[model samples]
Target chain A: MTAYKGYLIDLDGTVYRGKEIIPEAVEFVSSLKEQNLPYLFVTNNSSETPESVAQKLQNMGIPCETKHVFTSSMATASYLTEQREKQSAYVIGEDGIQKALEQAGITYEEDQPGFVVMGIDRSITYEKLAKAALAVRNGARFIATNKDVSLPSERGLLPGNGSFVSVISLSTGVEPTVIGKPESIIVEQALERINLSKEEVLMVGDNYDTDILAGINGGIDTLMVHTGVTTAEQLKEKQEQPTHVVSSLKEWKI
Target chain B: MTAYKGYLIDLDGTVYRGKEIIPEAVEFVSSLKEQNLPYLFVTNNSSETPESVAQKLQNMGIPCETKHVFTSSMATASYLTEQREKQSAYVIGEDGIQKALEQAGITYEEDQPGFVVMGIDRSITYEKLAKAALAVRNGARFIATNKDVSLPSERGLLPGNGSFVSVISLSTGVEPTVIGKPESIIVEQALERINLSKEEVLMVGDNYDTDILAGINGGIDTLMVHTGVTTAEQLKEKQEQPTHVVSSLKEWKI
Candidate 1:
């Protein structure tokens, strides 16, 4: 296997599953660190800040720092900055997305905004959704961090950011530009952050839909690990196969 | 013009626009009352109870009582009762839907419900949506009050009950059985309430999509008024025209 210049890793299913970290994934990241290979944890989670995410990973005994994490919020902010010079957004999300917008110098406005950015907001209210719909109808560019319809939780699969985003899109009859896994926007942005070309970077993750498909969509090689959502049998049904498939991250040669 | 035995009248646009009552519609209702024709105001609004809707109409000098009003809430409750003898629902909406479910003897359960009823909830939170989505995914029958994507408000067009309903439907990959206008369920239920057959009743409203389409879908006659959302010019684009179109309700003879 050809050695890649840099790696784009996925969180949740790839590195850890909920509260538990995959042992093989942990060892793989350690190897990357020992070899001094550049890598970034690319995640679609727009709720938690990079610091919080890094802290969780570090506590799990994984080698990670705030700079090593790149969330969908950061990608969305960077995308907005590239899309327009004057960035004012009516944002519906939690801390991570808000912080990213602030750090990117995007002002939050209620009435008339240049962009209507939607993320998974646990404190979502009708008034917030109403304001967003109105703004989008008034010709604001609609942008969503991800298009994940459901999120797996202890209780059950709950409505995700994509489901909430449908309210504005369905109501206003305007589709949003999604910027998460499987869309290629977040992967492209992550590659830019790592300062590596797509050809030189390999995207590694457990999920075939979000992680592997993201790499394929972004014109990069993908390494699929079977520790999460997609099983080996399910991968066979897919028309376009991943670049490489392994039982675990430990099986892949760096 | 045939003197209909009963009338399924619309609120918002046909009877009133916001807080102000349309004078021609007021006189039209008065004529119905004087001629001893049975009438019920059928609205897609599931937030307010029949009593509240009647109070608003009475305050505007329109002849109406609690019995003369039938909201989407009532229709949804009626549909559920007819569908299942022992119905237990996890409802997400306001006072109107809650009261209707209670009146219909449908118990509200969270953990495992037989049905997941979604309506217009202004105070909608992610927790409520999560619960509804989980319940629907767990084999609960998904039901929505209406499919009106947007509602016209003073603040402009806002996300309606249908948009919120999309969250649960989208997350669970289930299409809800809509019980409001354009679905024929509400109109059929309203016909039962008025004790009139579809041929004997004339559905009257201002919106071509909801009111007129409900009548058409229910196999009944319709009277479209030009005092609300659908202008006469806009109505021309529709392939299936309303049975009757008028500049004002006053122009039609009882």
Candidate 2:
């Protein structure tokens, strides 16, 4: 009775952007809804959570559910839990970070920490940096959320978590193994969560740097949608290519 | 009197790696100590705390103090605080995240976050994703710590923070504005902390991704020590080149 067993879709230009919804995106989702197809919102952005993303789509009349959304944050968290024994941690981020840690039942340090995890701390400070550096120097474990130097925006591209991760890595001389988009960790997480083999799922997105790379790295079929950031001309120039390409979600059979 | 008014140094290949220090690195520091030198350990790795890195180096027989460290985490976090009018947030990371927020005097939350920061949350969860997604959709600000997609390891290359940041970005339909290494924010933070002009400090590191980039972007002098991940051939092929390239930190003048 499942119209489609697994569907991993894109965000950004695919669903919404700057405060505008692209045409036909809603209709495309409506078709999936009419078919009772289960779809997942797979994205490359680690700055926000699925609930907020889904809510945005719905606000723009896309009719999305938070349950149907999965992010790199979820993927990376899943990957780390699988790779190591879960331990208490000191987080440097927001709800997305906390949710990930709590779901793993990893206790966090508000007072004293045994492990220091770095991400994009919008609220940064010298004391925080000193503490994190000290914790690592003193033998607390360290992990970074990701390593993106910049994220593109309507105004312009700007720095991201990689900059912060580098600071700690530079300061502590200890590199954090990151877990997020374009890495096998999130894909593996997605596969495990969907309860499907890699081949059964399709990765669709606009950006080649993260989404398509994620699919290729994760061992899934990738469908490049021209709806997001990358242009078709750009794809043709790439040394690598996706498994498939589409104009939008409307072009997919699922 | 300070033998050196300011110091900018490199990590990885310059300092200690896997229980061994590069030859003469210790002696070089000893010489600095023999004549009171004020120095700073600057690195491109964004995932760790400087205290931890300083300890790692000290363990390798190179003595360093926490005061002599600057990280991308602090830089980006500082930028975030400066841009925000209010200081409430939803975190998505580890010790670095909490520390940065507290030091910034930013109020943090699980819900109703004015700003949601995504970092390297190795322990991500569905609930966290949902919370962030919901908040961003509801108009909470989105920010990230860095943008490094891969990390260097004692073993090999691995997926890093950049990819994860992208994933959350995909989900939220909001791209993060970042502040870290290889960008002006962290560089400015470092300048402010040192209370010196860019001309007075020399950025040193092994990685071209961060250290060199930071100096170049910040308009500071950069020294690339041939000890870490990038090779001479790699440096030659860089889109941007460092001001000085040395065989080792020992051969370089302070």
Candidate 3:
């Protein structure tokens, strides 16, 4: 396929897995550097903020700065801050979520919250869920980091933060407005951060629904790769396909 | 307020805009028609089959199609079609996508599509869109129909199906999987054709989103009172709510 403009690369399955970046990942990024083509690490994983992701990437020998990275957590925080305007938010997640909220100038409240935010909190307990649900029931705006159903692991897969979001959603019947990958907040942020337009970017990833669809939803061309989650067999057998298909982002020319 | 297991009432700006439902709405739903109430509506908005939604209603709504009454396009179709055959499908939506395809004895394909199905064609486009997007791209499953975007007039909304679908999403996505309300193939169809479920249904109509949200997304809470899109003044102040809130579903609730 002809190279379009810049790139919007996925992080989890596309570049790295947990602490270890995938083989050829650095070179793939270096190629973008050589081309001076702007690329952003777009991830639906709301557990980590951009700064943390940048630090992680830097630790792994990938020369990425916080500016070149984006997370759904940032989008959720921005959207909530813009709309709710400094509301007192009760958060159940990680340092990433806390930092995002604080940076956005939102106050953190545990009870009678004006906002109830949920991220990928492994330490989630029924009590925490009750508190969060109670806050939402009492009129706090429910915000979720991301809705990824499963987190990729070397052990195959683990219940993602979405499972917890669902738990809270069940406790309180209000479905949180998901503002992640497929929802366009992250992509919108990426475009703004990189000074790029929809037509000037292409999204490359393995997941058909999340990564590829995010690009499509954000009004960009999408290339689906068969590196993770979706096997070649599934792609071949499935009816709906992406705008383009590749074996890996390593094979990407742009 | 004591929580009861009756009536899985919708909370989207209906009873509550963000913080709380209208006081009347809260009271009305709280004081339900019955107490042994376990009323569940299959609501996922997108990507879920009603069977899954019905199963996941927690303690909200009763999932039985017999005594209880709730409807979704998926549930409506499921009740209509019992044959376990895969018909061709050309869908413009998420995966719960295949539900209607399954019901109509249709299989979903992208390449050699048979039918051109469209429901709320969220992924709409222009020119070369309707002809190819749904039927060819997703594998034309069936020529479906859906025209509820402009429900019963007086909803004071913008032009709905006049373009949103036929021009924007539908015209580009494909013809449709189904269209129109009260059609034997639509929400009303399931109610009339199937001897199960409650008939004490109200064809609620709010502008576009509210009407469709309550109707096809899950269950027929079809309250389309002209509150939202009529004047900025209406939506500006969220006081005048709906029980059933469209101006011209044209029935006096009293």
Candidate 4:
């Protein structure tokens, strides 16, 4: 296997499943640290700040710092910053996205914003959605953190940020520039953050649709681990196969 | 003209615009009443009850009773009743849909509901959407009041029921049974309510997309007036034309 200089790892399915951490993934990440190879935990979750995400990883015996965590919210902020120097945004999200935008020096405006950014908001209301639709219709650039339609919960699969984002997109007939997994935007942003070329970085995740596809879309080699969503049986039917596939991270050399 | 025995009329654009009523529409309905022709006001609005709608029409000097108004909510309720004898539904909407379902004797059950009904809900929360999505994913029959993406409000075109409905439909990957105009479900239900055959009833409205398309889809003749949404120039681009077109309702001899 070609040794990569940097690793762009996925959370949830790869590092941990819900609250349970994968031991093999932890050992693999530790190996990356011992080899002095740069690695960042790239996540589509726009709800949690990097500090919080890193804290969770640390608690689970995984070596991670706030700087090692790259959320879609951070990627969105970076993308927006690159687009315009002083931009006003109409945001629909919780703490993680809001903090990211604030940290990126983006101002929040409701009436007529330069951009309309959407993330998963548990306190989502019709008024917020209306404002988003109106702003999008009024010619604001629409942006979404991720497009994961369903969120897996204890109860069942709940409506994800992508589903709520559809309200504005479908209403205003404007497609949002998605800055998360499978779209290449977030992957590109992560590569820039990690200071590595696409060839020098490897994207690792369990989900075939989001993680593997994101790597492929961003022109990066992918390592698909079968610890979460996608199974070995399901991967067989896929048209574009991942660069590398393993039953668990224990089998793969860092 | 065919001299239809009954008239199935559209609200909003056809009869009124917001709080303002069209004088020509009032005169046209008066003529219908003078001739003793049975008429029903069919609306895609799932927010207000038939009583409220009837009151609004009556206040505008348009002859209408609760029985004369047939909403998409009523159509949805009726459709559910016909689909199953004792059905349980997880609804996401306001008073109109709730009352209609209650009137139809359909019980509201959140856990593993038989059906998931979505309507225009201004007070929409993530929790409500989550439940609806979960129910739909859990094999519940998904139904939407209408597919009107946006609602024309005083501010602007706000996110309509269809937009909110997309949250569930997109999340669960389930296409809803839309019980409103342009689909023929609401029109079919309205026809049953008015006790009129397709040939004997003229669907009158100003909107070509909903009203005219509903008539065409339901195998009924349509009279398109130019008071609301679709203009004559816009209607000219349509392949399947209405049975009759008028600049004003006053120009048509009922």
Candidate 5:
């Protein structure tokens, strides 16, 4: 097997499910650290800052720092800076995205903006959506953190950021440029942050649709773990197979 | 022109635009009242009660009573009753839909509902959308008041009921049964309320896509007026034209 110099790992289903952490996954991450390998925890959750995410990992006894976390909000901020146009944006999100944009020095403008950036906002209101629709109709570039339709919670699957983003897109007749997994935008950004070429890094996650497809889309190898969303039986139905498969992350050799 | 026994008219674009009433449309309605022709204002608006809509029309001197108005909310209530199943729903809407459902004796059940009814809700929140998404995913029959993507407002086109409804639909991956113009469901209910056959009624309005298309879809004759949405040039582009065309409602002979 070809050795991967660095790793890009997924959260939620891979490391933990809801508030419960997977023991094997934690051990796997620890082993990577012991081997002196570089890794980053890439996530589609745009509601929390990297500092908060790192705190959550630390609480679970996982070795993580703020620099070890890469959120979709950070990716969205990176995407905006790359455009090099007007730096003003009409943002609809929570702490994570808001802080990320602020850190990137993007000014907030409600009436007219260069970009309309949306993420999962549990405090979403019709007025916010109305403003977004009006701005998009007036020809602002639309961007979304991620396109996960349903967010899994203890209560069940709730509406995700993609669902809220649909209000503006469907009303204004415009599609947003998504910046999370299943699209290569976030992956490329993560690659640059880790300072590694695609071939040298391996993407590891439990979900085939988002994580594995993201790796495939970004031209990187993927290790699909069965501890999360996709089962081995369901994996066989897919046309494209992941580079490696394991029942748990502990089975994968560094 | 064929002498129509009954008239099905639209409100927003036909009777008024925003807060101001159309002078010609008022005269046209007065003429219909003089001839003792049965007429009803069929609207896709699901925010206001029929009484409120009638009050609005009466204020404009259009000779209207509560019985003269038919809203998509009322049509939704009727649709639910017609199903004759569990008479309960998880509603995500304003006063119109809420009252209509109450009048129909449909109980509200958030936990486990028989239906998930949606309408234009300016007070929309993520919790409401989240609840609706969870309900729909858990096997509730989803229904929408209208599929009008954009609502023409003083500020510009705002997100309409369809846009809000898209959140639940997109998240749950379930298409709703729409009871509004451009869909024949609301028109069918309006036909029954007006006590007229499709052959005996003429649908009159300004918007070609909603008002005229509803007429065509309901198998009734349509009178396209150019006072509001669709202009003469735009109407000419459509393959299926309205049965009659006029610059204003005043031009049509009662």
Candidate 6:
């Protein structure tokens, strides 16, 4: 077996389920930290800043720092930076994406923007969407942080970023460039941040559709854990198998 | 030529364009009024009440009353009335839909709704959409007033009711039953309202996609005028042509 040198881990399902941290995941992460292995918590959540995400993990007794968190918002900002276009955007998101763009020196413009970036926003309104639709129609480049349709909440599945993204895309008849999991863009961005080759790193997550498919699309090894969304029975239905499968993070060797 | 006993007319393009009323349309409608021919102004706009729409037309000096206007909201309410399920809905819309649902005696619900009716709303919010998505995922029957992706405004093409409807439907992986133009439901409802059979009336409009298609879908004759969304060149590209075609309403015989 090829031992992985670094790890790119998913947040919500793999490290913690909602507000509760998984005991085995904590132990595994601690073991990685003890060995001084480089690992980054790569999340599709564009609503929280890296500092907040790191703080949440620390509160759960997990070893994490702001630098160890690679979010889709950061990936999206990085993606925009490489475009070589004007660094102005009409944005729809929360603290994370807003801060990411600000950090990247991207100016916020409502009209005649170079790009229109959409992320998860709980306070979304019609006027915001109308502006986005009009901008996109006027030929502004469209982008979405992630395309997770349904957000799992205690209140059942709510509208996710992708659902909101659809409003503009459907209205303007333009598809957005998605910068999160299930696409290789975020994975490549994570690889650059971790400073590791694809062959030496392993992507670990509980969700098959986003995390595992992302690893496959990015040409990296993936370890599917059963502690979250996809069950062992459900994983069997997929054609492309993950490189490794474990009942829990404890089942994997360091 | 068959002397049509009634007429189902479309607003916006057929009768008026934005704030300006079409002169040819006014003359044609006056001829219908002078001959005492029953006519109903059918529209996909679910934002304004029939009274408001009629007032807009009456203000334009085109003989119109509340009784002569049939909106998508009214059709949606009529649809719900024919359903065997309980008459309660979690709605996402403006005055037209709200009034129609209330007039139909359908109660407003949030927690456990029997149906989820979506329409055009300029004041749309994430909270309202979240509730609609949650309700739909909880097995509520989903319905949309119209499937017009973009709404024409003085500013530009903005996100329409169908675009907003995409949010809930995309999140829940559910398709909505559309009740407006191009679906035939509104046409059937208008026929019922005007007390006319399909063979006894002609559906007149300036847009081939919505008006003409609705007539064709509802098994009625259609007259496509060249004053709106679809141009004469565009109409020639369609596989299914309208029953009658004219450059202006003045070219048609009452």
Error of 5 at A120 (Å): 0.7
* C-alpha RMSD over true interface residues, model 1: 0.6
Please give the range of 10 consecutive residues that has the lowest summed lDDT in model 3 chain B. Answer: B151-160
The DockQ of predicted model 6 stands at 0.88
Model 3: CAPRI class: incorrect
Docking verdict class for candidate 2: incorrect
Q: What are the clashing pairs of model 4?
A: none
Question: Every model's Cα RMSD, please?
Answer: 1.7, 12.5, 14.9, 1.3, 1.5, 1.1
Worst 10 residues of 1 chain B by lDDT: B78-87
TM-score of 3: 0.49
> Candidate 3's C-alpha lDDT?
0.57
Residues A73-122, candidate 4: write the lDDT tens digits.
99999999999534989999999999999999889999778899999999
Clashing residue pairs in candidate 5 are: none
Instruction: Report the TM-score of candidate 1, chain B only.
Output: 0.98
For the record, the alpha-carbon RMSD of candidate 1 to the native fold, in angstroms, is: 1.7
What digit string (tens of lDDT, one per residue) describes model 6 on residues A1-254? 78889999999889999999999999999999999999999999999999999999999999999999999999999999999777899999999999999999999999999999999999998899999998888888999999999898899888999999999998899999999998999999999999999999999999999999999999999999999999999999999999999999999998
lDDT per model, in order?
Answer: 0.93, 0.69, 0.57, 0.92, 0.93, 0.94
Task: Return the DockQ of model 1.
Answer: 0.86
| TM-score (chain A only) for the predictions, listed in order | 0.99, 0.86, 0.90, 0.98, 0.99, 0.99
Q: Compared with the real two-chain complex, what DockQ does model 3 have?
A: 0.02
For residues A78-127, could you state the per-residue lDDT of candidate 5 as single tens digits?
88999956899999999999999999999999987999999999999889
Worst 10 residues of 4 chain B by lDDT: B84-93
- Candidate 6 per-residue lDDT, tens place, B164-233, comes to 8889888999999999999989999999999999999999998888999999999999999999889988
Docking quality tier of candidate 4?
A: high
Between prediction 4 and prediction 5, which has the larger lDDT? 5
Best of the two (1, 2) by lDDT: 1
User: Could you estimate the TM-score for every candidate?
Assistant: 0.96, 0.51, 0.49, 0.98, 0.97, 0.98
Off by over 4 Å in 2: A1-4, A110-115, A138-141, A153-155, B1-254
Residue-level lDDT of model 3, residues B86-111, one tens digit each, is 44544554445455557556555655
For model 3, how does the per-residue alpha-carbon lDDT over A129-224 read when each residue is reduced to its tens digit?
656766776788888877775555453344566655665565455788777877677788778777878877788787777887677777888888
